[model samples]
Target chain A: MSAVIEIEGLRKTFRSVRHGKRVAVDGFDLLVEAGQIHGFLGPNGSGKTTTLRALLGLVRADGGRMTVLGEPSPELLPRVAGRVGAIVESPQFFGNFTGRRTLRLLARAGGVSISRVDEALELVGLRDRGDDRVKGYSLGMKQRLAVASALLKDPRLLILDEPANGLDPAGIREMRDLMRSLAAAGVTVLVSSHILGEIQLICDHVTIISRGRRVAAGRVDEVLAGHDRHEFLVRVAEPERAVDLLHEAELTAAVEGTALVVSGVTDPTVISRVLGEQGLWVGELTPLRPDLESVFLELTGAGEHPSVPRQVDDSALPAGADDAAVIDLDVRGVDA
Target chain B: MNLVRAELERLSARRFVQLMVVLLALAFAVTAATTLAGSHRPSEAELSSARTQAAEALQGMEATHQQCLARQNSMTPPGETDDFYATDCSEFDPIRQDRLPIAADYLPGVFSFEQQARPLLYFLIAFLVLFGFLVGASYIGADLNSGGVVNLLLWRPRRLTVLGTKLGTLLGTVLALAVGASLVYLATFWVIGQTAGLGGRPGDDFWRSLGAIHGRGLVLVLLATALGFAIATLGRHTSAALGAAAAYTVVWELGARLVLEIVDARRPDRLMLSSHIAAWLNGKVRFWDNQLCTSSSGTDPCSGFYSLTWGPSLVVLLVITGGLTVAAFAVFRRRDLL
Candidate 1:
């Protein structure tokens, strides 16, 4: 599959009087395949939004090779801009203008049909309030309007920065569904958000970054399974005896509330066998898998990773290279 | 072109713009009504008193001139024609000289289109110029203030194109409003002039001069709008432009004039922005009863009028506008929208 967005060695530095010199993006590389909902994840101020702005030519990067829709960006942004709809940072509109009027202005400027204003409004579920002035709109409504604007051109590539910001659960769900539907219809979407669970559920592919560098990226399941150790929830009547029995067999096990969390073992049969040898009847055995949130925290070094020693600062090896070796890893300690 | 059309629609539809237009129209109507009321003809008793006094004074003057002429004629040879002596008494009729029964020359009447409309024209021109600047400044200022430029730039992507289109659209709208408002005032004044004993139809020359005056007013309006657009774009806000204008007029210009008064012999107030703006339009600045010019006589050196060469003033105006506009464009093209 062709990449919709590609970036290599992207670097951006900002100099301000109050903040002095700060590197917002350093050695960032990203690739998003066509027809996939790609998640661009990062900690706050980790350069996710900066990269998107640079891709859209809103901010000039110091050094980078970037492309969108197979074309090098900025110089060719205008050529491909008509087929790309984006909302960077926050949605801003003329306060005095009604939502419908704002859309009409965009339609006129973009040479799109005015009739699409109503359609775009309907798509975002804002048709009822489209006639109201934007200044009176709530923050969630503003976010929905931003989504509607991104969908106005029926763009093949949609770049949205925090598209679910200020949205309630229902609104976030609607946005997720809209993205899924758009991707289903062969549109490529690059969405950045801090909501890891939502990204995991909505995005087929994810590229995780920390300190302005890509730490891990691939299919969501693959990334989650890349942990160094496997884990299994072995539920038994005597949880303490189950832990001691696993210790005797050289298996790491700990009581997590009511269940014994067995780590460093991929096969659940070993856990069952270890417990059954001591006459400890196994009530249930459930395989524990790592969630995207835990994987993100571990890669970012913001959360505890007892099994894997993260070396994000090591320049010799590629980031996340150590985790790529494992097909399954222990994640029983991670919450569902 | 469609962008220009959209901008025009947006400018015209703005509430402030609508309010300004309504206020301008009300001002015009009030000026017309007040001017018409003040132009009421002299009372019948006052006219009669003035005519009787004028007739008596004329009879006295004629009796004296006739006696002097007769004495001169008698002193000359009978065969020689005294060409300097008054040969006819028919020209001394005061009633015939005072044909309109009122001082129609100073009042706004049908025949006084050129006389009375001159002040109204000046007032309209000044008001339009000031308001044009305001409208032009707010046009881009509101966008920057409200963060609308983010979406606008995303939609268009060409910064220079967006700026150029907006400036063109603003200039076009200001010029149209200036011309349209001028015509409305002219029509209103004409209707009011007819009701005030104004009966004669002005000739083509008067209409031509009126058109030329309005044409110059249009130029002034364009200059003000350009200045406002340049300043607002350069600062990225209307308040900046307004603050700068206030400083220039109140501090820079006034302070410089005061300093020049203490250190220089020349009248430096003539170099103020207000003076230059008036000079650009009027082609001269009138030094009305000032200490600098009241001591001098005639229309020569130190005269009551300082004529500004139209070509040089026009060049100065364009250079200022173009310089600010270029500076604004350069910054706008490079600066990142954050």
Candidate 2:
């Protein structure tokens, strides 16, 4: 399948009188396949937004080769712009214009049908407030309106940057489902966000970037597997003895609460066999596959530097997600 | 086409512009009404005063001619054109040669339409240009302040096309408004003239002059509007353009005039932008009051204003406006939107 967005050797530098020269994106590369919801994850001040801006020709890149929907970008941006929808940073709009009027202006500029304005507003659940002026809209409503704008063209490729920034829980779920539905209908989606759980739940493919460089990228599971240290949580009668025996066997193991967690060994039966030979009965031996958050933190070195603030706060974790497991592994991963 | 339509919509939708239009129409009506009310048939006393003054002037000229003729006959025969008697006789013949009209015994029975319309036309031209500048500046200023340029460019990324369309839309709107306002002024002035006993019916010559006035009025409106747009584009903010315009008009022109007077360099006043603009609007040639007029060369013609012809006046005005426009487009095309 052809890639929807291709970036090779992309570089961007910004020079400000107050800040001197700072590199925003350096030697960055990205490939997003067609018909998939791809997650673009990065820490604060990373090049995620910068890369997206360069791709859309909002800012001219210092050096790069980029393509969107199989056409060379920025040079041919106008040709393909009609079929690509994007919301960069935050949505900017005319305050006096009604929500419906704003979309009509955009639709007219893009040569899209006027009827699509209403259709897009309906799609984003903003149909009722379409007649109100944009200045009266709340932040969430404005975000919804921005989504409606992107949907007006019924684009083949959708790029959103922190689309869930100001959304509540319900709004975020709606946005996630909308992205999933768009991708399911054969549209390629590239979403950049700090919400790791949302990205894991909605994205079939993920690309993790750090410090203006791509550290890991692939299918969601493949990226997880490449960085996954097969950890098994075993609850045995003698948890401390189990950890000691696994350590004596040259395997990385540790005790957390009442269970012993072992990594660097994939065979679950060997774990039971070793503990069983020592006259300790295993109550539970469940494989602890790394979630996207753990894999992300591991890959981006957020796990290595505990003091550096993480993009995903503990409060942003989705309900029923394993916060304890994430913290436990991060601590152990630091020691290892 | 889309960009032009969008710009027109955006410009017309502003509430400030709408309020300005209403206020302008009200102001025009009041001015026309007040001017007409004060311009009525002259009173009997005023007529007698004007006639007495005209008779005195005619009587004085006749007496002077008689005295010069007596002196000419008493002096030596004319030897050359420069001799005292010859010079006095040469000046006397022309003064007494043309027949002067008889002093009017009564004032005009009605206010003249041409007299009433000229001031009204000047009023329209001045206000229209001033207001046009504000409109043009505000149109771009609001967009820059609100960060709407980025949003608009996202839909159409051709930078030059966006700026060109905006300027075209502004020029078209200002020109249309100016023409419409002039028509209203003319219609109101004509009605008042007829109501006040001045004939409203205009001759072909009147029509021609009126057309020229409106034509020049339109050019003035265009130049002012373009100036505002260019300044706003270069500065990327409305206040900056407004501040610059105010400074040029108040500080630059007034300061330059004061400096020229202090230094006794009045000849260079012909090149002043304000001077040319004023001359163009008044349909008069601008002049420099050089000290050569007061020199001891004994040249009679040197004791008056030296006319700056229409050609140079128009050229200077266009050069200033055109240079600003080109600079604006260049900066807009190359500068980063941020």
Candidate 3:
């Protein structure tokens, strides 16, 4: 597979008189291959939008290298721009223009056939409301119109930033299906969102950014597996005795309520034999596999601890850590 | 070319531009109605009586001129030369027959295209110039403010091309509208002249001069539109261009004029932008400057009249338009969109 989008050492800083200088993105790298639905996951203000802006040339990058569809970004991005569809942010349209008029103008500007306007509108489920002015449309309808605008060129690479924003649950599902269909049709998709569950479901490859740096990136299962400790929840008569017995067998074990959570188990027979001989009687044993959300929280420093199950809000971030301030650890084993 | 077409469509779609077009049509209708109400053709008897009175007045003026010329040497002072008392006799030259001060002429018997059209054309030009500026400003201003430019750039990806096409579309549309409006204005006034009043047919020179004035007016419209577009593009909002215009009027036109008047500056109109614009539109303008007097005594105080011609006016207007346009393009090209 060929690389459709690439960024290395990308750096950007915003400056204002009142706020002085603040780094928005620092040394961020991303690689998206052809025909892959790559999820770009990050916390809020984690430089996801800044990286996308720099890649699309909406904003200037202070330093770094970026490319889309094999062309150097910004300078050479125009060369391949026709083949790339992007929605940098939630773009606002002229209030008076109808959705159809807006898409037709974009099609004209992109040198695409005007006939595609109808098709694009249909694809985004905005065919019925295409003649209505944009201002009257709801936020979800505007999002659909934006998607229609992006699809005007029938581009091979679609870069959407927070595409699911302002979308209802059904609209989000439709967007997911649309992206999946696009990927299945040989178009590479780079979708950035903070919705981890959606990313986990729709994306085969994932790149998680925290605090302007890539913390982990690979297949969704592999990234989750890297943070997986291979633990098990055991239900026994005596949870305390089972934990001590598991500890004597050189296994890490903890007692929680009425269950014994044991880690580093090579086989299930060891737990049955060890606990059965002690008359503890293992009633049930279940493997506790890691999910994307837990891995995401742990890597993003939004979790209390890996062993303790907690919500994202339970962890307290350090002061001034809103700007990502994440741990930079790369879990390799990703296919090039 | 596609980008230009897109921009043209977008510009025409703006409600403000449409409102301006409606206003222009209203102005034309009002002008025609007012002009019709103020003019009428003279009756044969009224014409004869006016001609007789004009002839008598001309005879009396010639008699007065002859008497002055005859007494010129006798009225000379003791030490002064005879020529000093010889006033310019040409000032007493008989008025042309066409320009005779007949009651009908003064009471709007004939609609002289040469005389009436200049002011009307000036009114048309002012209206169209205002229309161009506001339309141009709102056209680009709404785009930048609404992220339409960013959306266009995503498709086109050539920032310069996008900005340039928008500007080109604005100028071309403004020029076309101005020319069309001027034609309609002239044709309507001509029809009025032929229908309800004496149609004084002007010669080729009058047509040529009128054409030239319209041409200058069209250029002024284009320049004003381009300036408005450029300023809005730079500031990324329509209010930016409007604010700048207001600031210039308050600070330069009013405040500086008052300050210059207080200081009794020499040729203060030289630094005034309104003066340059007036000179550009009217060919040339003459302003009085008290500072140019060589002798300030009561006996013989000299007055100075300075003319600001078309050359300097064209240069000043072009430099301002070109400089702002280039700056706008440069900033749009290099600066971050967000």
- TM-scores for every candidate against the unseen true structure: 0.80, 0.81, 0.87
For model 3 chain B, give the 10-residue run with minimal summed lDDT: B78-87
| lDDT tens digits, residue span A1-336, model 2 | 888999998877666565445665667799998898999997766577778878887667889899988888778877888888888767778878999999998887667889999999988889999999999998888999988888888999999989898889999999998998898899999999989999999999988776566777899988888867788898998888888888777888899998888988878888888888899999998888889888876766578657866552221222343333221111101110
* Backbone clashes in model 3, listed as residue pairs: A211-A324
lDDT of 3 by residue, A29-116 (tens): 8999999999998766667877887898888899999989999999998899999998977999888889999998888878899999
True contacts kept of 3: 0.71
Scored by TM against the true chain B, the candidates give 0.75, 0.80, 0.86
- Compare candidates 2 and 3 on TM-score and give the better one: 3
Count of clashing pairs, candidate 1: 6
TM-score of chain A of each: 0.89, 0.88, 0.88
Output the number of the lDDT-best candidate. 3
DockQ of each: 0.20, 0.18, 0.41
> What tens-digit string does per-residue lDDT give for candidate 1 at B1-338?
77777777678877778888888988887887777776654455655665676566667766756665675457755434345543333334344452323334433323355456767898999899889888888888877666667677777777888889889988988888888888888887787666664445777877876676778788988988988988998877988789888988788688877877677445564566676677766656554324565565542234234455556767777888889989988988876565
What does the i-RMS of model 3 come to?
Answer: 7.2
- Cα lDDT tens digits for candidate 1, A224-284: 8797468888788989988988899999999999988888896778887877887888898
- Stretches of candidate 3 above 4 Å error? A233-285, A302-336, B45-105, B108-112, B294-301
Among these predictions, the greatest DockQ belongs to 3
Question: What docking class should model 3 receive?
Answer: acceptable
Interface CA RMSD, all predictions: 8.7, 8.8, 7.2
The 0-to-1 C-alpha lDDT of every candidate, in the order given, reads 0.77, 0.77, 0.83
